[model samples]
Target: MFARRALRAAAPAFAAGAAACGATTAWLADEADAGMFVVRPGLSASEYKPLVVGGVRQHTDGTTRVRFVMEEPDLELGAVAAAHLMAKASIDGAEVAGRVAPVSPLTAKGYFELAAAAAGDSAMSKAISSLKTGDVVQFKGPVQGFQVGRNQFKSVGILARGDGIADALQVATKLLSDPRDDTEIRLVYSVRSADQIVLRNHIDALALLHPRFKALIVADEAAPQWTGPTGPLSKPLLASILPPPTEGDSTVILVAGDVDAASGKATKARAAGVLGAMQYSPAQVRSL
Candidate 1:
């Protein structure tokens, strides 16, 4: 009887151990699935850095070819952003400008040849086509890196559409323009100019509904002849958009431009002043 009782006691213990193991296994499985997850937050303007890659040759057509090695083939944009943040705390302040080899499965020769064929006759397309073996070209922008997770890597590879300086600037601008204080806004801007126009129109419509926005400032270089706010965006014009700064609340500036905010003293200085006044970067501006 004593032996039977002991066995009965041990049976529950064994079952409990088994249950614990099963739970652990399930947890591990779930974690494994989550390993490769990546979240692509909107790009930022302050992150733009001018990339200069040597040994890169541009084709007559304007396509550019670059050769670089990437250690992680599965890396996604989110992973790259995470890595960038780790390297630099303020992603908006620093820029990563260089042409390095893609990690794997995407050889330089293969990538350029395919890119050239796809690009056809565009300036960037021609530049990509001219890339010969072992060529390198520079990519300029606020380098937005990615975050790598278990079983997955995020990478916004150089040359991928929608990952350019203009796009980054649009995202940054939107964040700064957000009316809500606590809400986080994430967005992606397109490299295509037409998309930017559409975004500008949308913003104008929103302004009609919301009184906070007094006017929209568009860069003169790409300004259309539309009736609404269209012309060279100037500091005075931008200042007019925000209500006078109050003691507790501050004003924000939204700038949109293809010009490099760094490099020359003029652009850099202007950007700094704007950033301080607006408490945001150009990336926040949306086309609409």
Candidate 2:
């Protein structure tokens, strides 16, 4: 005991050591990032972290969604508002970014997702081409720019299309599961064709889960099985559902979809007086 006390007394008092130890101790799951994640625990903007491909889902639209699980079970890919991740398969490889899925972590717990093109010369396309189950891919981020002041909004709207709707759906689901006081959610999903309608089961479950929240689906051609609204997802249609958003960022509208759909819908939504149409792809994270 005397020798141990003498050693402790002789130990150098490195100020940074305490700070470093505090940093290490605060490495808990970032679910407590208020409403947005700016500082990640296991992930860094400058450091590249290796994640293994756990699975892949091939969508009918020639797009593929890859799922990567963190090496540690307790590790998490943070979420909400613009918190996102970027990944590269090999050194000097292409880079792809995606908002870590909400409600359900991509495919499984501790897993994150990235979207890749079927065929293209694009940087993201090239970067993810080699991804397969069990393969290692380097990840960067949890990068964020926008922050969400939860109580500031009177309501929230999500305009999404294609497979990208999955993320939006998850958000809606989370909102329903964990209702925000005095705030409402409006979710709209559009597909070019009825056959392209994926995740219908989850969508239906969410609709049933919270009847108060608006869930609208638009298809180019209405199929008999689809009991929801039909025709193109036009601003006129949305205008009927949601009053033109008032000024101020409080009226949050999350816009998700590919170039052909979301781009014009967002413009038209704004033209219809809808404000704060945040992009799910190009703006926050690129999975297209």
Top candidate (TM-score): 2
RMSD of 2: 9.9
Scored against the true structure, residue 247 in model 2 reaches a CA lDDT of 30
Residue 201's lDDT within candidate 1 is 41
- Overall lDDT per candidate, in order of appearance: 0.27, 0.51
Estimate, for each residue in 191-223, the C-alpha lDDT of model 1 and write its tens digit.
233222322443345346544323333322233
Give the range of the ten consecutive residues with the poorest summed lDDT in model 1. 1-10
- Tens-place lDDT per residue, model 2, 1-288, is 000000111123443453454322122123323232122245556778887888877765455667777665645554444345655555345345533322244223366666645343244443554467877877776565234333446666676665446556655554454434345767777765565565566667666767657777777666776676777555567765542455335566666544233333322222222222422223322221
Determine which window of 10 residues in candidate 2 has minimal summed lDDT.
1-10
Residue 215, candidate 1: C-alpha displacement in angstroms: 7.4
